[model samples]
Target: MSNPADPFVEELRAITGAAHVLTDDASTARYVGDWRRNYPGAARAVVRPASTEEVSRVVALCATWGVPVVPQGGNTGLVGGSTPDASSREVVLSLDRMTRVRRVDPLDNSMTLEAGCTVLAAQEAAAAAGRLFPLSLASEGSATVGGVVSTNAGGEQVLRYGNTRDLTLGIEVVLADGRVLDASGALRKDNTGYDLKQLFIGGEGTLGIVTAATFKLHARPDKVVTGWVAVRDPQAAVELLARLGDAVGERVTAFELIGREALAQVLAHGTPGMRDPLAGEHAWAVLFDVSETSALLDPTPAVEDALAGAMEQGLVLDAVLAASGQQAHALWALREHVPEAQRLDGPSIKHDISVAVSRIPEFIAEAGAALEGLLPGIRVVCFGHVGDGNLHYNQSRPPGMSDAAFRAREEAVHDVVHAITARMQGSISAEHGIGRLKQEAFLQYKQPVALELMARIKHALDPENTFNPGRVLPLPVATPRPSSL
Candidate 1:
């Protein structure tokens, strides 16, 4: 156990106040575990600093002590990116204390928020200002600004508003050795040099700690139309989205593809009174939303026309549109509760992958077949933002298989899935990032030159490997040696 009176822990207490530095097992339990419970960790102490300056100071002190620092926001990450490792020598720098909305500019359509501001809270703030922050995620209530920006998160709205990287205008980072880099501003265009903030946007805290950020906001939708449509297959769902985009342009804000198996799990284990939107059993379904800024213009008719066209082409099997706001929320509930349902069900090996939008159907078909061939009766729960070609392709164990026996085959399962992903020229990791779970696969599949460049950047930005080591990259990048006389 880490002693509170230890010199380093005492220094952490002095920096963030004794109450903010958590060292006890009870107080630090939540910070050490990843959201999925796949990577439970131990931390020497979780220090919650309120301001950017305090973060900088804490980081600098850790550098002086040669201690590892795991920069954490809400700890709601999937791949063990934000949680510490089992070694209790590392200090978890928690940003949840720094929840402050510094400013909201209506004219600029920008909002500056401290690192700990929750995604849901940010959206609420934007709504209060009569604007919209379009980055939406299943974990939005607990996922923090710093975590999203660090992971460069992509959620349901990527079809319209883009990823966190696209929405981010500027950022403020605390670099190794405690240097503060203030890049947070509302500049839409600056053609000076390379965009440095891009490095930290998806760096996963391997490069630096993101303390604050400025994000672009859009006009709040006056009308939102949500629909649950059963499709013939993945190909049909893909075609439907393309046709919808062509018909309504950017008004199609969110698009989600759900498999029948996934929906079954939700209905079985999700919230009570949760009923399927469509009565008939369909192999595949899509839940999507269309929003309009002008209340006078209804997107419903256009949506109806698009679905009608799809039906004419034998693409859509069945469909239902939410008639009221309550119905829309209920429709959304089915899509959002999938992860919880999976959790309640049992252990499953999950993969976050992406291929070309046109190749989504083929990838699913091939990958699903490949898994079934390898392990007979392996239930596949596949779904995601097909509009962006990303899917949560997961595998539940075959019936009568022990969890231990199933988990033991994880490497084989990943090998089959990742090989197919590579064959399709798709990413092994789409939005979840190359955290500890995928580091070996990343090193295996990533281009050798790209790995070299990543190593060089890590060495350049964090020579001592002070920030979140062994999270993204496969191994610790050795500091370069100096030439001697």
Candidate 2:
């Protein structure tokens, strides 16, 4: 019989051209690791396929050979879902070359795009059609549609437009056996049966590889009004959101909460032109925007009136309304730069958790206190899409602490915060899907029945575990051996 390894590599090269098959360690090294540099994996080769048919063939060949495949997009995922494992038995299937805009139906307000299209590219395509693809993210320039859909990525605008799952209407997936499940129809109200598209939407490529997707679009907003307001705390921020929602409803596109420490990081590490929106130091702040589809209808007056009312009621301590588009963008930069600033500051423990909007204050206050008590002088950088109750709560090490020591205590820190999150009936992983990083937490915090159901679904679809092994689901713990004495 022919050598199995030789034939497998040769078949992959024949399927997607030798140029697309990368075997050199230099090229393969980049695909084996994640963006966060946390999970470093090893792969025999990295294959680039350009079409759904090519993907189908590749997956089929891998399935037949019993070699695992990990599907990757732009490689901008926060979690290590797109990276391979340490074992060299796997192959990385990258979709970066499959970027093509299949269809743009302006009348239907929907667009069909290949998996590799960048999020920014999709937004620009929608704009060209005089429509709006409201899914926005800080990583939009590098984050791909396939990756976003797999993670059901939530961004600053999730409060109004919802996540990737909400925007996706149809999908074309390549199954484990290389079968093309083409459900990429443009219909909106198809009450047709299982609505199977959802399974792969946020599956993180565990169930199948999403080759292409059809996304629902909206009418482009003609005007946008932005503002920055200082609030007493999370409670006040929640109340202000309630007040604004009661008044403006869907026009309220984005509402973000930034803590004083987070803002300080921005000022310290941000560009020279960046400035704090509020004059004085406040414990908490909120950035909001009101958008309208009609250029003639200015929403600023209404937003200003609401702010005035909020100030009168003492919900807002201090505030600033953007005088121009430049100012609005500047204010937004402060919020967007928090992640980069935190990175510059040094190593930190990160947690993306959510509680009920009403209970956000209690969760933060309690979780912060608990973490501080656990590790005295630990810096808690808490902020996120507060309108939706998701907080990117992170902890920076103390001045005298070593990075290794801080990392060693990561589990203890997560336990304290996740415990409090469980108490509030909150999610341990929000926005970011349960990739390898949170698989342990998924098993620990997720209900037994729910986890069983998830495992059942995973097993039912990809029995061979050919797609993204060691992701989303935690491995079974080995039982301790009995004493031999």
Could you tell me how far off, in angstroms, the CA of residue 404 lies in candidate 1 after the best superposition? 1.8
lDDT of 2: 0.90
Write down the lDDT of every candidate, Cα atoms only.
Answer: 0.92, 0.90
Q: Per-residue lDDT of 53-142 in model 1, one digit per residue for the tens?
A: 999999999999999999999888888888888889899999999999999999999999999999999999999999999999989999
For all predicted structures, in order, the TM-scores are: 0.97, 0.96
The TM-score measured for candidate 2 stands at 0.96
- On the 0 to 100 scale, the lDDT of residue 146 in model 2 is 92
Best by TM-score: 1
Give lDDT for model 1: 0.92
Output the worst ten-in-a-row residue range by lDDT, candidate 2: 476-485
- Per-residue CA lDDT of model 2 for 1-485, tens digit only, reads 85456778899999999999987788788788887899998887899999999999999999999998999999988878899888888899999998999999999999999999999999999999999999998999989989998989999998898989999999999999999999999998998689999999889989999989999999998888898999988899999998888878889999999998898888999999888777888999999988899877888777888888999989999989888899999999999999999998889888999999999999988988888898999998988998888999999997799999999999999899888998889999898988898887878989976776777778778888889988898543222233332
Residue 1 in candidate 2 has what lDDT?
88
